[model samples]
Target: MYQFNFNFEEFLAEYWQKKPTIIKGGFKNFVDPISPDELAGLAMEDEVDSRYIAQHDDEWDVKHGPLTFDDVPEDHWSFIVQAANHWHEGAAQLITPFRQLPNWLMDDLMISYSTPGGGVGPHIDQYDVFITQGSGKRHWRVGPKREDYEEEFRHPALRQIKSFEPIIDDVLEPGDILYIPPGFPHDGYAIETSMSFSVGFRSPKKQELLSSFADHVIANEIGDVHYHNPDLPARQCSGAILDAERQGLENMLRSLLDHPQLMKDWMGEHLSNNRHELDLIAAEPQWENSEVREFLTQPEVLKRLNGLRAFYYPETPTVAYIHGERFTLPSECEQVIPLLCDHEEVTGEMLGEMIEHPAVIDFLTQLINQGYWYPAE
Candidate 1:
């Protein structure tokens, strides 16, 4: 377990999404959970979204991977793997401490291996990130939040920005952490071969939320009430939609969202669905409920799949949204949903007590068979 040596509440109040700050020795005597070689292997997987950015002749280039080891240049290159937490258990542990943030907002653990002179160039991210140094050193520069920075593209694939006056210009060593809020221009280059674990918290854009909610409403056959004018007032101009008419139209849409149950359902389902793929391997031969119960009797650990987002709203205690699906949990097992949602590890003993209830046992069996939770190897 990694010890996060900063006061989270203080950080949230003082710096989160407000400014960029460096926390020196955030993880004392830090040891990298995943190595460069291991990260390279994951990048070679077809399912994994991996890319390398290289610079030559003052021009940058990018290549999407399933790349060979030979494809990675010795210097002036950086390899980045998105959602490494999903596939690598060790890498997943790095995100555990950041769980202090809301689970729904937590995105993924993006691991990167950079060679000397390696960097993606100065750019702004739309999401907040905590970049933790794992090994070696990196010179990081972060500029104050600015809206007018123009993008200067070195490569078609890389969206970099013109250089800005840096508010933070420092070299980070092992255990150091850099907290950067959204829209802050920042850049980092490895002084030596180094590893960085970035835990990102992304907020949904208004358009994205509206789009997703619309899809949910359509699929569920809700929010289909048509606009009606029971009392039609004669208008001076037929072409003009009256102010009352416009307000009514807006209210009609707002009313749908105002419905508490409807909003909760959409919020649970939509937020629970992660954009990235989870590392899931379904049980080869599906286990029966009896087999599931039998397995749970032992003191073995059952781990939730890494990067699997689960959420339960306090308003609807019995319902849980796990990976885009809602499970109306049994009343007897209401407490179980929070355990599953909030924690990475769930021991068999934890569920063993709840297994006496058939509904609970069946739910556990379904979860295990579906590969949401698996016995720890």
Candidate 2:
């Protein structure tokens, strides 16, 4: 387990989304979870989203992978693997410490391996990120959010700012963390061969939420009530959409959103949908509820699949959402929600007598058979 030396609460109150700051010795004596060679091998896989970025003579080049690393020059090149946590168990563990933040806002862990002098250039990102320095040293330059900052595309695939006068500039060694919020201009370059693990967070735009909610309303056949005003007042101007009539029309849509249960249903389903692939392997012989109950009584452990998004709203505790599907669990299985979503590993000691509940047993069996979780070997 990685030990964090700083206070997360203090960091959130002071720096989160407010400014960019460097937390030195964030992970004391931090050891990298994945190595460069292993990262390279993952980049060769077609399903993984990987990229190669290099700069030479002030010109930039970008390539989408499945890449053979042979053509990559010895220096001035970086290999970036997106959603590495989905594929690598070690990478998945990096997100455990950041659970202080809501998992709904949490994005995947992006691991980058850079050669000497390698970087993606100075640019601004729309999401917040906590970048942890891994094996070697990287020099980072971060500027405060600015309205006048101009972004230019260095390569056809890469859009970067012309430059920024960095307020926070330092050479980050292993175990150091740089926290940057959205729209801040920043850049980093490797001083030596290095790896950086970035824990990113994203918030959906208003447009996206409206669009998703609209889709949910349409799918469920919600708000079928049409406008029929029984007491119609005579309006001189027919072309004018009366304020009262407009308010009524607006209330039609608002009514659907006003219901706590309906909104919760939509929130649970939309938020639990995984944006990245999960590492799932179904059981060879699907186990029955009896078998799962028996296994839970043993001294073994079951682990949640990497990158699977599972969530439950506190208001509706009995309803658990996993990968866009809703499960209305029995109140007897209430304890199972945290076990299923909060924990990466569920041990017999943790489950205790709760596993014996028929509802809980059946739920676990369903999860195991579907490959959302499995016995730890």
**Alpha-carbon lDDT, every model:** 0.89, 0.89
On TM-score, the candidate that comes out on top is 1
Regions more than 4 Å wrong, model 1: none
How far is 33's C-alpha from truth in model 1 (Å)? 0.9
- Model 1 TM-score relative to the real fold: 0.96
Estimate, for each residue in 198-284, the C-alpha lDDT of model 2 and write its tens digit.
Answer: 999998889988999999999999887899889789978989998889998898878887898888889889999887777777877
Cα displacement (Å) at residue 324, model 1:
0.3
Error of 1 at 128 (Å): 1.3
Give the lDDT of residue 34 in candidate 1: 89
TM-score of model 2 (CA atoms): 0.95
Show the lowest summed lDDT stretch of 10 residues, model 1: 347-356
